[model samples]
Target: MWTVGHSTHPLEDFVALVRAHGVHHIADVRKMPRSRRHPQFNVDTLPAELGSAGIGYTHFAGLGGLRREQPDSVNRAWKNPSFRAYADYMQTAMFAAELDRLIALGAREPVAVMCAEAVWWRCHRALIADALVARGEPVLHIHTPQRAEPHVLREFARVENGRVTYPGEPELF
Candidate 1:
């Protein structure tokens, strides 16, 4: 599976970029599938834009980010509350089910997870990549239309039996 960020790319360039990577389907993982600054990526128009290029688009709203951290979150390794909450959500059955569907779709054809952030690590895409890694799916991040980087699971992540968690020692102070 692959991940791509809209990153201010024009609609035509976005189409070409996915085409360059041979992506047949796009799984949008944006909590709110609309961009005030980049209207072309809004749900109301993104589907048709990609469809016209013979690419498919599906919004996986359940898999979107912007999750809230639990009061007793188990993912202490993530200093970012948003990321920690997303990691916590990854432990849910809902997330697992949706992820399985995505994996199956990817097994049939090239699939890329779409989000709005241009940088993978800076976005919740990094947590998703870690989950994908734990699930044994090879994940790559599209940098440019012509370049991509292989995803490396975070060194702080703990993976066991295809499940991932971010754990840190409790504060001594």
Candidate 2:
């Protein structure tokens, strides 16, 4: 499985990137599928556009970002409030169920989770990648049409018994 950011790429470039990575399906993880700045990537158009290119697309809003931060968030490793909030959401059963769907899709075909950020580290996709990595799932972050890098779980990430968390304190071990 893989993750790709739409960034500001042209539609063709995005398609080429997906194709180059052998991604047969895209699980759009944007909370809102519409991009006022890039309407071509909107839900109404993206699915058909990908279909025309012989790739599949699905909006998995359940995996989308923009989650509320818990007043008592445990993901203190993330200084960025938004990232910390997403980390909190990752602890929910809903997130697990939705991620299971994504994993199942990858089992059937190559799937790339998509978001608007240009890089995985800046997006909630990184947390998703952490969850995948914790489960022993391999994930590649597609950098360009010709470049993809294997995911490395965040340095501060603690995976104990298959649960990923980012506590502020350094691990004693």
TM-score: which candidate is best?
1
- Candidate 1: which stretches are off by over 4 Å? none
**Candidate 2: Cα lDDT at 108:** 98
Worst 10 residues of 1 by lDDT: 163-172
Judge candidate 1 at residue 37 and give its lDDT. Answer: 95
> What is the Cα root-mean-square deviation between model 1 and the actual structure?
0.9
lDDT of 1 by residue, 27-77 (tens): 999989999999999999999989989999999988899888887778898
lDDT of candidate 2 over 1-173, digit per residue (tens): 99999988899989998999899999999999989998889998889989999999988988899999998778989989999899999899999899889989999999999999988988999999999999889999999878999999988999987779998864457
Q: Give TM-scores for every candidate, taking all chains together and pairing residue i with residue i.
A: 0.97, 0.95
lDDT of 2 at 146: 83
- Report how far off residue 33 is in candidate 2 (Å): 0.7
Every candidate's lDDT = 0.91, 0.91
